[model samples]
Target: MDNLPISSKYRSRPLEPLGDAEREQLAERLNDEFARGGIDTDAYRAMLDQVFAANTLGEVASVVASLPAKDTFAVPVVIETGTAAPGELLPARTTGLRAPLLLVAGLGTGIAVAILLVVLIIL
Candidate 1:
């Protein structure tokens, strides 16, 4: 047993010690999950405490396991294809007073032309 390689000995180990960087990374992940509404305030505080108190990678893994899976709680994505069917009238984009103002202007022009024609005929 004493002659076994260090790697082989560690392979059977139940818990591997965690480094500062690993612990911080796990803490950050927990914080992100909390911010995304995956976990509640009580759960966040509990998990955060567990993250700091964890001495090994296995301990951190247990803490992570208590939270929801990332994909399960993630927001759904919506993609839109702007294509319309042939001859389909898509919704018109409006600038304020455009259609109404254009109609008024066109009618005014027609009325002025009619009045001018009438005056020219009378003269």
Candidate 2:
């Protein structure tokens, strides 16, 4: 028999911290395994403890791999970076505080300067 690796390993990163969302997902899957009798009571408790105590993605992954019926699951991620469609009725700008205030103040100053120039021209 040829000796081969049973699972893929994340070789590049050794200590990537797991995010809160991922941790919750791992805990949920652990619960499912426990409910389906894939994990015994003793082992289920231990794995639940490990899932919550896990600090890295690898830790949670290891727990998942130990399940009797392994899923080999990977969560899908979607990110939208494109702007809105053309002719779209986009909402008004709701950020920043100084730009509008400065514009109004500058307009007043410009009007004052224009009035001064007219008065001078008339004199």
Candidate 3:
């Protein structure tokens, strides 16, 4: 039986080895789950071991599969002081233009004439 080749089902490598970047990301995900108490110390250590030994992204994904997904977006809450903390993401600003534009358009010709009169009076 020594002459028999190893069975393919148990013998060869099927997945690429995990890289540093992927390892770091998996560690961070594991930390997030641990911090959230989703996994206890023993489980965290076990999963972390899996992450370090992981051969592929699929393996890393399986390691985190039992934990709740981490929230990707963080909304920064600001106080009335209006100063944002360091590293906080600022909310977007938009001009309040659309409502006034639609109102002016709907008022029709009489408002247009009145606006023209105001400009003429100013001139």
Winning model by lDDT: 1
Instruction: Please provide TM-scores, in order, for all candidate models, with all chains considered together.
Output: 0.43, 0.45, 0.42
- What are the Cα lDDT values of the candidates? 0.73, 0.71, 0.70
Residue-by-residue lDDT tens digits, candidate 1, 26-121: 788888888989889998898899889977765666565655544435555875467888778888876889889999999999999999999999
- Model 2: ten consecutive residues of lowest lDDT: 1-10
Give one digit per residue, the lDDT tens place, for model 3 in 1-123.
122224321123226567898688779888988898888999899989988987765565556556565556777786556688987888888758988887778888778899999999999
In angstroms, the error of model 2 at 55 is 1.0
**Model 2 steric clash pairs:** none
Off by over 4 Å in 1: 1-13, 68-123
lDDT, candidate 2, equals 0.71
Local lDDT at 30 for model 3: 82
Pick the winner on TM-score between candidates 2 and 3.
2
Best to worst by lDDT, what's the order?
1, 2, 3
Tens digit of per-residue lDDT, candidate 2, span 52-82: 8978756665575675444567766775455
What global local distance difference test value does model 3 have? 0.70
